[model samples]
Target: MKTYYDVQKFFRRFGIITYIGNREAEIELSLIELQSLKQEGVISDEDYYQCLGVLSYEKEMAIEKRSGKQ
Candidate 1:
């Protein structure tokens, strides 16, 4: 299973920075970045969904960690 760090590393490999703080801010920034990538044709809908999936998984892991459930 992939961990949050793995997801982060994957993004870093592509030169994309991942920010984690203030859930609202993170979501806002992620949406903006994803939109930019889509508009630039750098990623297709499928790729966008895949990336979003990874981000979502990482977010869930973070939540679990913070809640001391992991």
Candidate 2:
């Protein structure tokens, strides 16, 4: 999970697809799904952390981008 595309592919493996036009919202939903999978023991710690880091980075970038427009 190095990029946002990787994150989407990760979730797709679990039959999960997320996208609602907003980058921040998409990341937030992905985080929620990731947490649920973690709690259910559906994913390993390594994958979870890797995806989490990517999502966090993407979220931060989205935030910065949105703020820059204001």
Candidate 3:
């Protein structure tokens, strides 16, 4: 996916709507889910890496937001 919203949409396709009241935690879980899907061969290497990159970017942005950087 290109963004966290896209990732959320992807998870929604499987009826997964996870939220533990923590944005960072949710993104982390999404990253884990993406990794799992990659390991299971459900997605290609390119797709896996692309999604991970998006998640990582989101995580970094979240951290920065929490730190009042942007």
Give the top-scoring candidate (lDDT): 2
State each model's CA lDDT, in order: 0.65, 0.93, 0.84
Q: Provide the TM-score for each candidate, comma-separated.
A: 0.54, 0.95, 0.83
For model 2, residues 1-70, the per-residue Cα lDDT tens digits are 7998998998999999998998899999999999999999999999999999999999999998989952
**Ranked by TM-score, top first:** 2, 3, 1
Model 3 lDDT tens row, 9-65: 877776777688899999999888887787788877887787788889999999999
| lDDT value, residue 46 of candidate 1 | 79
Number of clashing residue pairs in every model? 0, 0, 0
- Model 1: what TM-score? 0.54
Error of 3 at 39 (Å): 0.9
C-alpha-based local distance difference test score of model 2: 0.93
Candidate 2 vs candidate 3: the TM-score winner is: 2
Instruction: State how far residue 25 of model 3 sits from its true place (Å).
Output: 0.4
| Model 1: per-residue Cα lDDT at residue 5 | 51
Considering summed lDDT, which 10 consecutive residues are worst modelled in model 3? 10-19
Write one digit per residue (lDDT tens) for candidate 1, span 1-70: 1444554454565587757667645645665676677789877677677667766776676688779999
Q: Residue 18 CA error for candidate 2 (Å)? A: 0.6
